[model samples]
Target: MSEENKKGKNDQFGELVKSMNQFFHDKPVKGFLQTMDEFFRAPFPFQSAFPVEVRESKDEHIITAQLPGVKREQIQLDILDNYVTITVQSHELFTEEDDHQRPVRRRQSMQRSSRTIPLPQPIAENKVKASYQNGLLQIRVPKQKGKKILIEGND
Candidate 1:
């Protein structure tokens, strides 16, 4: 082939590669790969697992959790022994329409997250108070006085 023909072929090959790269970038494959990479790079125990902070004082224990986009009624708190578990269930619906006014996509998703924290000391279940405000849930439970236990020797 002549020099001009070789240059023309190389230009066409470059254009072909550029177009292929653009096509892949525009497709969902690239997005999926990015999402997967983020998922793997994330630290263990996903962020949606209801991150909580517990503070203990001389009289009471306070627990606070970050729960955005969740309704108060959707949250459930349970105290079993020295463990406190907070669970939240939520459902979201999303719809998209094209220019023609026809629905192009409809998505419904449900998410549930729970986090259990073991208290350093026992609490007074009857005096426990919980409140939710502005996407934050706080629970205050009074600490119980430590009881003395007698150990009996086995005969």
Candidate 2:
């Protein structure tokens, strides 16, 4: 082909690549892939994000979880009957600098992680308590008691 034709074809190919990139970046599918990418990039996709342990006593159940680099306000704990759910939302700030030592782009990203665990016995929601110290989160839930039934003796 002629040089003019080659140049035109190259320009068209460049435009096509740019359009594809933009489409991929602005699509909801990209958002989903990004979410999955974030999940897979965590310390351990299945466990390390919020490693939790449950211990049960005669009167109560104790739960402990480790959340490194997270703030106390970022943690939310929910108790529903015998199940305990914990959610943590964290934010990270990223800055891109130019050669002149000036920031060219700045962005803040948020990640949310949640885990639900079942207790050995049903718990009393009114008596549940939770506390966070350092990077450790601890929760105490009082076990629900069943009332004994009294039966009348027949003659």
Candidate 3:
């Protein structure tokens, strides 16, 4: 075989390996591996991002978030200036006993996640109400009323 043909074969092999690496690191395969690791590594906490929506009404601003597997007590909401922050903290504990009545395996995991959203306008922080039910967190805050300004145009 000629030297050029050997070089071409080597380059092709390198390109193939690079493409395979890229494919494995891409979203689909990487996400599956992360999910499986989270399931098997009970001693390690896994944090995942959820979805949130903010809506505006005539009188109030409503914020909704989906938080499956999260308890109401694990969630915390805070409003500062025009920004609202949501935080969730969770802990799981598991233990297994042996035939001799001694503890064999014990696992504990703690996870925390937080998200912050800025409102389009200021709100009445003191009047904010929040509720969590059916794995959904909803927050309602009254919008602050702004004074109207009138401008006169010269003819």
Candidate 4:
């Protein structure tokens, strides 16, 4: 090919690359690609699960996590005054039975969920109570009762 033709082709290629880069830089496609990359390289997203609630009262702090269709034995909880972590894992197996001569196909799936919560102050370890019912995990963490600061009348 002629030198002028080669130079023109190179210029066109460079301009195409620049325009593509500019378009992706100004859009969410880059973020989508990043997520896809992470999903392929890792087992789960860093923040996949967000179904949890924390409630506090004078007596104790309660943390409830919604984990429907998960077995009781698959849930774990660790409690501390400064932080609490919960992890839930489930595995399901599906099977098809054939009486005479058909082939049976089975599929197994696994799901894992985890969450971390931070508390204002440390609580007693022995005072923690946890329960799981109806696919809901509930934890009651009793805070170390703090001394009340009585405010005197203004001078």
Candidate 5:
């Protein structure tokens, strides 16, 4: 009687393990899909919506910012001892008009835009120049030279 009871308990434990394994096997694809969805939904904070470029040379540092539909008056430039700042502001405009033949109203929209950039190195104050052309803003900041110090000891 004791041997029969032990055999019955082992069979029950085996059945429980088999049922748990089947549950996991039936939903394997769901588990994998959920993992992939989480991975793709991760946020990217470092990405920029527009493009910009910066270049440096022996004489000066150059910065070119793209502003497709922006105007010259919408931008500002600020310079300091070791850095330069550029700021652009955006404005919006809306228009509505009625056609003579159809009497239908049409709507149009526009957005104002702005951006700023800070230079890595200080530039020569007197030699800085800036200009805008063909929707591109360019700045040339001349490099400043450092003065050398001479020390002499008493003879």
Candidate 6:
């Protein structure tokens, strides 16, 4: 190609690259891509490893989580102040043995997933209750109990 044509082609390629970079770095596009990246990177998209649902009532908060393919022994629950954390851990074992009863190519892997939720009101840790059944976890956190004290000077 002639020098002029070569220069022109190089300029056009550079412009294309600049425009693509600008489009990808734009605020809206970057934000959307970040959101999508997080969703896709999670073990379970939108579920954040597992689905969690919290329901609030006048006195207590009810929290439920879906943990399909998980066992009761693999689940853990923790409560501190007004926050609830649920963690699930599992281990996988693989072994390829020959007929001679010797082990070859043995591998063990561990996986853990967790989620933390904040409650609207202070919880009564002693009064909190949890249960796991059929790969489902339910936690009830009761609001802290307090005696009523009247304030007269402010009125």
What is the Cα-based TM-score of model 6?
A: 0.61
**Residue lDDT tens for model 1, 1-155:** 89999999999999999999887787377766665685589633325677799998888889999987678988999988888899888776867688998986676667778999899766567889999999999999888887799999987
lDDT of 4 by residue, 1-155 (tens): 99999999999999999999987876367756765675589754333584999999988889998877677898777776589999877676856567975645565667777899998889677888999989788889887877999899988
Per-residue error at 110 for model 2, in Å?
A: 1.6
Question: How well is each residue in 1-155 modelled by candidate 6, as lDDT tens digits?
Answer: 79999999999999999999999999778867866785568644223368899998888889999987788898888888788999988777867687997984565657778999998767678888999888789998887768999878965
Q: Which 10 successive residues of model 1 have the least lDDT summed?
A: 42-51
Which parts of model 1 are misplaced by more than 4 Å? 11-15, 18-22, 25-46, 49-51, 122-127, 148-155
Regions of candidate 3 where Cα sits further than 4 Å from its true position: 1-47
Q: Which candidate number would show the highest TM-score if scored against the true structure? A: 3
Write down the TM-score of every candidate: 0.64, 0.62, 0.67, 0.55, 0.49, 0.61
| lDDT of candidate 3 at residue 141, scale 0 to 100 | 82
lDDT of 6 at 93: 84
* Model 6, runs deviating above 4 Å: 1-48, 98-101, 146-155
Q: Write the per-residue lDDT of candidate 3 for residues 1-155, one digit (tens) a residue.
A: 99999999999999999999999899779866765786788633435566889998999889999988788899989888899999998887877687998985666767888889899776668899998999999999888889999988997
> Which candidate model has the greater lDDT, 2 or 6?
6
lDDT (Cα) of model 2: 0.81
Query: Candidate 4's C-alpha lDDT?
Result: 0.80
Candidate 4, residue 154: Cα displacement in angstroms equals: 14
Instruction: Supply every candidate's count of residue pairs whose N, Cα or C atoms clash at under 3 angstroms.
Output: 0, 0, 0, 1, 5, 0
- Candidate 5 per-residue lDDT, tens place, 55-148, comes to 9898778888876666788777777767666666554443434465553334333333334556666667678899998888888877667698
- lDDT per residue for candidate 2 within 26-143, as digits (tens), equals 8476866776786678734234357888888888788999987678988888878688999997677877688999986676767788989897767677788999988889999887
The list of candidate 4 runs beyond 4 A from truth reads 1-47, 93-108, 147-155
